[model samples]
Target: MHQPTVQDFQSLKRILRYVKGTKHHGLPIIPGDSQLCTYTDADWASDTSDRKSITGHFTFMGPNLISWFIKEQVTVAKSSTEAEYRALSAATSETIWLRHLSAKLRLEQNIPTTIYCDNISAIAIAKNPVFHGRTKHIEID
Candidate 1:
């Protein structure tokens, strides 16, 4: 942040272009129904250099895409399920923040936001916190 690099300049240019292209696009704020939904996924050991996983998620506000991101995980995940769980955790955090922000903005947000993840094993791990043999590594996480 202190020093701008070439990559930063290129990224800024890309953002400017995207903003210009979507200048007319705006999110609709409708009344009566306010719901929060999110989908999360991760690739196990996607980065060969550091063996780190990649986390990606998309958040929606009543069918409209409100937020999304894809980034390298801080720590390497031992299994695909672990990676997916990490992504789901991140999405859940965002969902909570968005819910609070919506309330602050006078939007009627319902409690208990929904988050979808593809990995059944990850879901199982989340559902049952009992540390099993397979999920021992991710227990502390």
Candidate 2:
């Protein structure tokens, strides 16, 4: 910020224009079933510079999107399955936090939260109780 450039000014103007254009847009939270769910995915090694994966997930309460995020993974994953599993881990943490919040608000969830993932290998790894050699490198925390 000390040495502002022309590109920085142009970027600021572009952001302001986008904000002004979408000022009328709003997120609607429709009241419905209290089923908590999340859909998670990852683009493996999408960043060519660092070879880090991109994690994205959407957490929903019933039909309303309650939480979502897109971020670069802290560690590099060796495969697409690993990337997706990491994203799922993040999403699960978010879902647990939301569940606790809902419980405190007197909206305790009766059913278990569902997590949807596109990667079959990741799903299989999650379902398996034993951590095989393939996944032994992953940190457990």
Global fold similarity of model 2 (TM-score): 0.79
TM for candidate 1 is 0.73
Scored by TM-score, the top model is: 2
| RMSD, candidate 1, Å | 7.0
lDDT of 1: 0.85
Cα lDDT, model 2, residue 109: 94
Q: Which candidate's lDDT is highest?
A: 2
RMSD of every candidate to native, in Å, equals 7.0, 8.8
Which regions of candidate 1 deviate over 4 angstroms? Answer: 1-22, 25-33, 131-134
lDDT of 2 by residue, 55-128 (tens): 99998888998899999999999999889989988999999999999987888999999999999988887887
